[model samples]
Target: MTIEPLLKYMSNYIDLTSDEVVFLESKITVRKYLKGQYIVQQGDICKFSCFVLSGCTKTFYMDGEGQEHILMFSIEDWWTSDMGSFITQTPADFNIQCLENSELVMFSYDIIEDLYREIPKLERFFRQIIEKAFVASQKRIVRNFSLSAKDQYLYFRDQYPLIEQRIPQYMIASYLGITKEFLSKIKSQLILEQ
Candidate 1:
């Protein structure tokens, strides 16, 4: 795996100097994970911030009755980590599971402080990333309250056009906060309307 994709992604937010690049190269590690592998399990401390080089993963939490509620899906070029756990070095409330064979570029929590100090622009980049994620989360919450189930499915389809094909229908149902049968009915209604 190469860090080129990561460099390109970073460049979108901040131009990296050669020295910064070299430092990052030395600190980052690339790892491969197979489908069904757990990158970060609930109750485990998340030591790494993972960036998807290829493939997809789901970040989720289980309820008291053991029903999984998917919070988000991370695909190529997206970042995935249990932010609360990674930042505080506490046990994670969420689980990150690979949905496909994946390659990830990871940065350890141990060196992140050093990286921020050495590369000041890196802090701005992460701040912006966090801001965007926060905004998206807020919007999702609003949508869940304001939209109907059919509208929610449509919105999800428009937002992640390729994700429907990549993952299972039941997984999408879970993400949509609906039963698989309801999702199927909504989909059928859409098809008939079309």
Candidate 2:
């Protein structure tokens, strides 16, 4: 399926002409992954930057005690990748896994680099994407620090209502920095109050 969201995302930053869209479409490859599969594993040099078409994926890393602490989640219309690795051509510290069956439009780093070199407009697009991503990441960190577990859960649920339906409960808990049992308790408490 064509990624209409990609066009929309590009449009938000820079207007793409019909000819530019056609050229961009030619460089993008649609990829699919099954649930529990990794889109990119830790230590592999990232080759592509992916835009999620459907489903949920997480970026996380195992900590000293081997807990999988989440960095971010990508749902429909969001992009997923270890962008640092993708750009630097180095081993990724984060593992990106599909939480459910997912479709993505992937742009090869090399090809896109070529595109940016030849068509400078693509650089502006990427720069804008990265700038926004940095801001969002900063906000997430601030929220995680300030919000209580229940508040965080509530906020995340409201922010990505579709994400809850698409991803497993345990993964959601992991993303929220809580145990599955804690999440269950929170849900039960919420129900009781309601």
Candidate 3:
């Protein structure tokens, strides 16, 4: 994986000095997880923010029936964490798991906070990322409520095309708020029409 993309992405928000970049990079721990491995589990406080360098992860919440509803997918360059737990230092209500063998640049809460203080530009960069994420979540929620399941799946694939190829159909169905059976039927129908 190229650090160039990540550095460029960060540059879009804030200018980083060489020393600051080096310092931030020094604090990051490169880690890997196998598919189906839990990155953050329910009841565990999220102490770190994981930045995906490659592979996919799913954030999901389990229901009383033991069914999981996927809230989001994190792919290359995306950040994954149980936000509530990270921000509040409380037990997580959701789980984040690797959908594929993955590598990430992980930063602990303390490290991030320390880096932010040392590099004021980093704080600005994080604020920008957070704002963008918030807006995207708002738009996603609106689409989920207003769009049909098939439409939602289609749009999600269109938006995150790489995610479609990397993640499982069942998990994609969960993210779309539809049953696996229903999603399979829809896929079959679409293929037949094509």
Task: Highest TM-score: give the candidate number.
Answer: 1
Considering summed lDDT, which 10 consecutive residues are worst modelled in model 3? 1-10
Which candidate has the top score in lDDT?
1
Off by over 4 Å in 2: none
Better of 1 and 3 by lDDT: 1
For model 1, give the 10-residue run with minimal summed lDDT.
Answer: 106-115
TM-score of 3: 0.93
Q: TM-score winner between 2 and 3, please give it.
A: 3
TM-score for each of the candidates: 0.98, 0.91, 0.93
**TM-score-based ranking:** 1, 3, 2
The regions of model 3 sitting more than 4 angstroms off are 1-3
- Residue 80, model 3: lDDT of 92
Q: What C-alpha RMSD separates each model from the true structure?
A: 0.8, 1.7, 1.6
Candidate 1 regions with alpha-carbon error over 4 angstroms: none
Q: After superposition, how far is residue 94 of candidate 2 from its true place, in Å?
A: 0.9
**Candidate 2 lDDT tens digits, 17-100:** 788778888877998899999988888988889988888889999877988978888988898999999989999989999988
- lDDT (10s digit) by residue, model 1, range 1-194: 58899999999999999989999898889999999999999999999998899989999999999999999999999999999999999999999999999999998897777889999888899899989988999999999999999999999999998888899999999999999999999999999999
lDDT, residue 116, candidate 3: 81
Query: How much is the lDDT of residue 173 in candidate 3?
Result: 88
